[model samples]
Structures are given as C-alpha cells and as structure tokens.
Target chain A: MLTIENLYVSINGTPLLEGINLSIGDGETVILFGPNGSGKTTLLYTIMGIGGYEVTEGRILFNDEDITHIPAYERSRKGIGMSMQRPPSIHGLKTRGLVEMCAGKRTVDVEALAKKVNLESFLDRDINLGFSGGEIKRSEILQLMAQRPKLLLFDEPESGVDVENMALVGNMARELLEGPSEPDAQHTLHDLMHERKTSGLIITHTGHILDYITADRGHVLYSGHLCCADNPKRILDHLKKYGYKECIRCLS
Target chain B: MKVDLSKYEFTGHASEKVDDLTRLDKGEKESMKMAGFDASEKNRSASFVQIDHNHAFCKSYDPGVEILPLGLALKIHEGWGDLKWKLLKPEKDEFTRLAADSTHGGYVIRVKKGAKLTAPIQSCLMMHTNKVGQNVHNIILVEEGAEAHILSGCTTTLADQTAAHIGISEFYVEKNASLTFTMIHNWGENVEVRPRSAGQVETGGIFLSNYVSLKPVKNLQMYPAITLKGAGSIARFNSVIVSTENTFMDVGNRVILDAADTRTEIISHAIASGGHIIARGHIQANCSPAKGHLECQGLLLNNGIIQAIPELDGRMEGVELSHEAAVGKIAKEELEYLMIRGMDEEEASSAIVRGFLNIDIMGLPPELKTEIDKAITESEKSMF
Candidate 1:
C-alpha cells in the first residue's frame, strides 16, 4: 500500500536517507532493523511528512498517490499514523483528548482504549507529560489504536516499555494489523487481514518484535541504504550470529 | 519637601458654607455617588459636591440606549444621593461624626451567606461625544460564605478627541465569601480611560479579578488594588492587554496582605503590535506568616514595545514575597511545531496566545468561556 523509490532525504545539507527504495503490500508487516544513526528514524519521519527531513530526490507514494509534499496532519488525515520513539509531552492536553482529536470524533470510550493498552489510570492525565517510559509507550499505543490509520508506522515501540506490557503493545499492534473481528475474542483482529488493505512499517533494532507479531519481511538499513530484504526471523538470527559488520560488508 | 501639618490646621471657616448646601454638588463627589460612593457627607464636604457639568456629554446609535441615557442619568442620580449631598445641610455633631467615616456609594448589594450565583451580572458603559468627561462610582458587598461573579464592559462609539472616562469601584467581602470580577474595555481610538478600583476581604474570603482590553486607545490607565485584611484571606488578579496603532496602555494591580495567613497573587500578560504596553504589579505582605506573589509576562508581536515591572515587598520577617517578569516574542520552535500541525503562521501565534490566556478562563462560566474562545478565533481570522 506504500512505495518509496530512490528516496534521498537530508537535514541541514547532511544526507540521512540515501537512495532508499522499498514497498509494502496490503496486510504486510515489514520490520526495519538498523543501529543508532542508521537513518531508521529519518526514513520513518520522511514517510510521516515531519518537517526538517527534506526530500532532496525521489518520491513517496501512499496507495499510488505522491505524498512527498503533503503536510504531516494531512498525512494523518489521509490514514497515515505514527507512534514516535520519543513522544512529546503536551501539557494541559489530556491523553484521551488528543486521542479523540486524532480520531476526529467528539467523544471517546477512553476507558476501553485505556484498558486495551493498560493505561486506565493515566487516561485523564496530561498527554505523556510526567509519564514514565512505559506509560508513554502505552499512550502511543492508545493513540495508534484511536487513529486506526490505513498505514501504521511504529518507531521503537518496544523501547522503554515494561516486559509485562510489551506483550500488550505487541498484541495491540497485531490486532491493528489483523483488523477487528469478534467481540468476545479478548483481542479483536483487524479486518485488514481479510481485505489485505492495511500495512505497517515498524522500525526497530532489537528484533524483539518477532516474539509477538508475524512480520512478513525485514530490511536492514545501513549508512542510509536498504542493504537487504528477507524473512525477519532469518535476518534477525543471522545478525545475532554475525553482527552488523557482516551486514555492512555484504552491503558494500 | 515635607509640609508641616501641625501648624497648618486651623478652625472651621463659616464662609465656606453655601446657602444651598442640601443639593448634591455634581462633579467628583456626584460622580463618586453615581459610581456608588457610600460614605457619609460629613467628611471632606468641600470636594464632595463639585459638579463637572461642563464635561457632560452623551451619544448613541440606537434609539433605546441613547434615549434612555442610562449612563448619564445614573451618574446624576447617584451624585444627588451621596454623603456629600448631606454635607450641604450638615447637622452639627451628627454631620461631624459622619464626616470622620468613609461613605461608600448608595447601591449596596449583599449576597447571603453560602449563596452562589452561576450567571455573571453584566454592566456596560459607553461614550459618544468628544471632549466629554465621565465620573462614576460603584460598590459591591459580598456577605459571609457567599459567591458572586460580576462582569463590567465599557465601549465608546465616538471617534472624537478629548473623550475621557474616570471610574471608581470598591468591593467588600465578608468572611468565607468569594467574589470574581471581570472587566473588558473596548473604547474608541481617541478615548482616554482611567479606572481606579479597590477591594477589601475579611477572614477566609477570596477575591479574583480579571481585566482584559482589546481595543486601541489614545491612553488608558488603571490601578486595581486588593487588600487582604483578614486571616486566611486570598486575592488573585489576572490581566491581559493588547495595544496597536500607536496607542498606549498603562495598567497594574496592587495586592496588600494586612492580616496573618493572608495570601495574594497577581499575573499580567500584554501583547503590543506597533504600539506600547506598560504593566506593573505589586504585592505587599505586612503581617507575619502572610504570603504574596507577582508575575508579569509580556509579548511583543511586532516591532512595538512592551514593558513589565513586577514587585514584591514583605515587611514581616515570617512573610513570603516573590516577583517574576518575562518579555519576548513567541517561541520559534513552538510556532514551527504548530505550523507543521496544519496551522498557518497567524493561527499558530494566536493558538499560543490563547493558551497563555486560557490559564484563568478555566474557572469562568461555560458561556463566557465560549464567548472568549469565539473572540480569539475571530481575532485569529483577522490576523490571517
């Protein structure tokens, strides 16, 4: 559902994403693995239309529509939602309020969403302000659930999340990908699985996501280039055995 | 340059007495009475009844308001009933006894203990002629354990020069009472407005005042003071002002903590776009264990100027006092973030402005909050 061709992005004249190309079909979950400063976040931000990540060359197409120049909120309105690795603290704005705002609805069943993400106690608190690391991750998951976007982008969703709730985040992500299915399932699957229309591009370095969701493919981004695309479990196991040096050598 | 008052005092002069003393004189005292000055006329009788009749003026575009002459007629009637009017026919010992006391205006409104009013009482004053001067006095008395909200708005229709308005207001809050006063002024470009207001609070009473001005005026000055005279009394003042087109605005608030355990807070926010705004706030704690604080924040939208001076004085050793002032343009990072979120430049700026002023509106009534939100939206549209 999303395509990137020869995409080159830079900030302050420093190249971040160089000649990157990738595409994700409907109902596909693609995990991006890269070390720190390997253009993983830059690529996610470029896809999300955040400012300061200028596209010097190439184009990003969402459902075959060129969205290189689309604004961030417009991108959100067009069914592109992202969970930032480091979410911003918005004082005086309740977490539920922001979720409702993003959902484009007047009222929200905040309690249900909070329960889904295990954030019932913090729903009335300021948006991610004064929250612990785990709380922020949970809040991001709640927001993602509220947006219910066509294409979901998760930037380090596992980071700072507690071990116990990490499973909840993973389950929530899987449900979002699978689409809503039954009422009493405890975890409702997304309809995207049946229609094969929803997709996700998750950014991670740990490969821990393999424990929860079924990732279709994995790509290693090194020094601003997509080195390879293969089965996520296989690539992650290979990286664990050989480390990034082998990946870099293979890329060169 | 201290004058010796010991030898300057002399016996009463009979020549100062006028034959027609019974009639209330019209100028300052009459204006005060009209504005609700309630003091007995026995004190300061000479300055009480002097009417500034030459300055009387009125204007109205609507027949109802113009024909009613509510503003002018109210002033005249109030002046006629003030303590100064009684001084004209002083009754020897009785007049002397009353003279020593300060008489507030005649209109006394007392909210019963524990009574709470949800709606705001709105009062409007307007000016229509050039070279016209006005003086008015108002008094409000809130009884023990009561709560009240008062809204006063002023506007001028005339564009003529030399239009002036002088207003005075006094408020009294008994123990455990709470009072909120909101004032909004939108005057013509050439009008000069001066308002002096004071409030006294008894034990456990709370007083909150918010003053907002959105129009460009030739000159505007006001000093609103609150005195926490009872233990556990609390007072808070919040003000916002916007000056444009070479206009000038001078506004401030003074908070005095006179009783032990009293507390006061003052906050002022000003925005200047091609004009000048000067704001000052002072908090004084005179009794032990009293606490006072003053904060002033100013934003310069254009090349215009803004000055804020905040002061705090604590005379008692155990009292606490603090002051803070900040002046700058909107933060660039915040602006860009909002802009990236679909808001244009003007919208971003106004959003921040609205956020800055929304601090106090949280306690306002829903209807008033909606009105302010609409006003901010309209102003944002105009800027765009």
Candidate 2:
C-alpha cells in the first residue's frame, strides 16, 4: 500500500534521511527501530507530507499514486494518518470537536471510539491541554481511531503510556491493524481467518509495544540509513544481546 | 486634551421623515433581523425600536416591567429615578454636552422589586437619516431582588452614509439584583459613535455587560465605567470588536471595586483588519479583601494597527489586582494545527480568529447567545 525509493529528505537544506528505500504491503504491520537522532521521525514526517521536511531526491507512491508533492492535509485526505511523538496543545479546540471534524461526513460513533482509548472523560476538554503524558498518548490514539485511515503511522506510541493505558492503546492499535472486533459464541475457526486487515508502519524506541502487536518484519535505521531488515523478534534479540552501536558495527 | 465637538456639531433640522410606528420597510426590517430584533411581537414585553430621531415604537407587554421614553421617564421619575446623569457621566467636555443637548429620545427600562423576568427586554436603535446626529440618553434600573436581561442593538441602514451617534446610559442595580446587558453594533463606514455608560451595583448585586461591534465605522470612542459600591457586589465587562476597512476605534472599560469583598473582571477581544484599534482596560481595587482581574487580547489580521493598554491599580492592603494584555498577528503553529485537521489556510486562520473572539460570558439566554455567535461568525467570514 506504500512505497518509497531512494528517498532523501532534508530540513532547511540539511539532509536528514539519505538513500532510503522502504515499503509496507497491504494488511502488513512493519516495525521501525531506530536510536535517537536516527531520522525515524523525519521519515514519518516526510511520508506524512509535513512542511519543513523537504524531499531532496526520489519519490513516494501510495496505492500506485505519486504523493511526493502533496500537502499534509491532502495527504490526510488520501487516507494517511499519524500519531505524533509530541502534539501541540490547542487551547480552544475541543477533543470531541476535532474528532468530529476528522470523521468528515462519516457517522462514526465518537464517544464509543473515545471510550475504547480510555479517554471518554477528556472528550470535552481542549485538545492536549493540561493532559498527562499517558492521556496525551491515548488522545492521539483516539483521533486515529476517529480518522480510520488506510495507512497508520504510529510514532513512539508506548513511550509515555502507563501499563494500564498501554494495554488499551495496544489493543486499539492491534484492532486497527486487524479487523474490528466481534464477540460471538457460534463461529467457525475459518471465520476468524477471513477477517479483514489494515496496513501500519509503527516506530518504536523501547519496543515495549511489541508485547501487544505482532509485526511481519522489522528494520533498524542508523545514522540516516536503513541498516538491517530481518525477523521482528530476532532483530530485537540481537539488539538485546548487543547494543545499537554493536548492531550497527556488525551490519557495517 | 478635551475633545472639541465643533466639526461634529450638525444641529440643523433633521429631514421631515414621518415616524412610521406601524410600518417597517423591507430594508429596515432586514436590518432589524440582522440585529436579532425580529422576534415575534407577542414574544417581546417592554420592547422599543428607535430609527434616527424618531421613536418608532415602544410598548409594555408585562406589568412588572415598564418601558418609557427618556423624556417622559425623567419627568415621571424626577424625584425617584436614578437620573443623576451628571454624577455618572459628568459633562466634562464638549462631546458630553453635545450628546446631552442634542439628544432626541431614549429608553428608560425598569423592573419592579422582587420581579423575576423570564423574557428579555429588547431594544433596537438604528441610524436611517444621512448626516443626522442621533443622540440618546438611556437609564436602566433593577430594583432590589430583581433579575432581568436586556438586549440592545445599534446599526445603520446605509453602508456609506455619514452619521454620528452619541448615547449616554446609566444603570443601577439595587441590593441582591442581577442584570445582564448585551449591546451589538453594526454601523456604516462613515459613521462615528460614542456611547458613554456607567453602572452602580449595590451590596450583593451583580452587573454583567457584553458588548460587540462587528462593522466598519469612521471613528468610534467609548469608555464605560462600573462601580461596585456596596459590600459583596460583583461586576464583569466582556467585549469583542472587529474593525474593518478604514475604521478607527478607541474602546475601553473601567471598573472600581470600592467595598469589602467586592470582585470585578474586565475582558476584551479586539480584531483589526485594515483598520486601527486601541483597546484599553482599567481596574482599581480600593477596599480591603477586594479582587480584580483584567485581560485584553488583540488579533491583527494584517499590517493594520492594534494597541492594547491594560492598567491595574490596588490601593488597600488586602486588595488583589492583576492584568494581562497581548496583541499580535495569528500564530503559525495555530494555523498549521487547524490545517492538519483538514481546513485550508484561509479556513484555518478564520477559525482561529473566530475562536479567539469567542468569550464565554455566563448567564445569557441560549437564543441570544446563538445570535451573538452568528454575528461573530459573520464578521469572521468578512475578514478573509
């Protein structure tokens, strides 16, 4: 559903992501593991079409359509949604109001979606205003659920979330990748195999989100380059045995 | 410097336009609807409508509420009314004398003691004659233990007519009474308006004022004052003004907390687009245990001028006073945030401007609040 080829991104003429090639297939979940200053967020923002992240070289194609020069809002309109590591605090914009706008002619049950993220109590408050760390994460997930985008980009979703909220956030993110949930007593196992799926590219630092989500593949980004692509659990075990530097040294 | 009213002195006889009490033309009726004065006549009690120098209509639909002409009210309440006009709006300059002398007619709205009015008293004042100076003197009184709401609107019939409106208003809230006053203005591009007002809140009384001016004007200057004279009284002033074209405005509110445990709050939101605006707020806490806060925020849509002056004075040892003022163009972060939510640049900026102008004042009728929101939205649309 998403493709990038030799993509070089820069901010204000300073190259951040150089010679990068990545892609996420339909219904596939990919985990991106990178250390600090490794341009993980820069890649996400560049793909999301956020301004100030200039694409110096190469192209980005989503669902066979070139979205290299599209604006951020238009990118959202094309079914690309992101959860930021640090979202801004909008003083007068209510969370419910923003979610309603994101729904955009779709009769989505906002209150039910907010309840899934444990943010029902904060639906009426200003967006991200006076919210705790965990609350902010949950609020971001709430908006994503409301958006129901085709390609979901999760940035540090498990960084500040607590264990209790982590379970809820993790469940919601899993539900986003898998199909919607349904409790049934009379259902064949084949019915479960026929569930619809969604595409997701999640960026994780602590990899704690791996406890709840099953990824098809994992890639390590180091020093503005993709270093390795392997099994999700094996790469994690390799990094656990040896730190990021040792992994980068071995890859080099 | 004292204001010289020499050039503003247009004392010639007004054109002989017959006052039609029973007739409202299409344009005049549309103006009234725009001002939120098109409610059913049966829905209104103690209603009045004034166009230029004519007292178009005045009627009382309830016994507890009385509406009368200013001249007749002064004559009837000569001994009992709160007509100490000079004490509140002292004839300190030529402009004051001009308004007091050339005044045609105004409304004197009074609610009897212990009266709880369910419906608001509505008043519509408009300028229809070109080059006519429409001066009015208004007085409102709420007797002890009474509760009332007043909605007053001022507008102009023509967009380019040259006119001037000078009004002097005095309000009195007795002990345990509460009054909510809302004023909306829609003036022409060449009109000048000066509305001088003051209020005195007695012990345990409350006075709330909401003022909005969302139309172009040649020049407008007003500084209304309110004093909490008795113990435990409360006063609040909230205003939103949007100036467009070549309009110039100098508006402010002053509050004095003189009794023990009294509280006052002054808030204003000013928007200037291709115009000049100087928003001023002043608050003084004079007695022990008194509290006051003043906030003024200005949004400049262009290179047009905007100045916010906030002054706070605390005299007594236990008095607490604070002021916060800000004036700037729209923030890029705020604009981009809205864009991320799917609005274009123009839509995002206008939404922020509208939200900035939205002040949550308490105790307004839902219908009135809707009207006020509609007016603000209309002004926001004209900004871009």
DockQ of each: 0.18, 0.45
Q: Candidate 2 clashing pairs?
A: none
How high is the DockQ of candidate 2? 0.45
Off by over 4 Å in 2: A35-38, A89-92, A111-126, A183-197, A220-252, B1-22, B42-45, B80-82, B359-377
lDDT of 1 by residue, A83-151 (tens): 777765543456665666556654667689888878888876766678877788778778777777889
Assess candidate 1 and give its TM-score to the true structure: 0.70
Grade the docking of candidate 1.
incorrect
lDDT of 2 by residue, A99-178 (tens): 88777668789889888887889987878889887888888777877778888899988887888888878878887777
Residue-by-residue lDDT tens digits, candidate 1, B51-150: 2211121222222111112233346556423423221222333222232232212222345567666544444443433454544455566778888765
Q: Return the TM-score for each candidate structure.
A: 0.70, 0.88
Best by lDDT: 2
Q: What is the lDDT, from 0 to 100, of the residue B152 in candidate 1?
A: 56
Interface RMSD of 1: 3.8
Model 1 regions lying over 4 Å from their true place = A35-37, A85-147, A159-168, A181-192, A205-212, A220-230, A233-252, B1-122, B128-131, B157-162, B240-247, B256-261, B268-276, B284-308, B311-356, B359-362
Model 1 score (lDDT) = 0.66
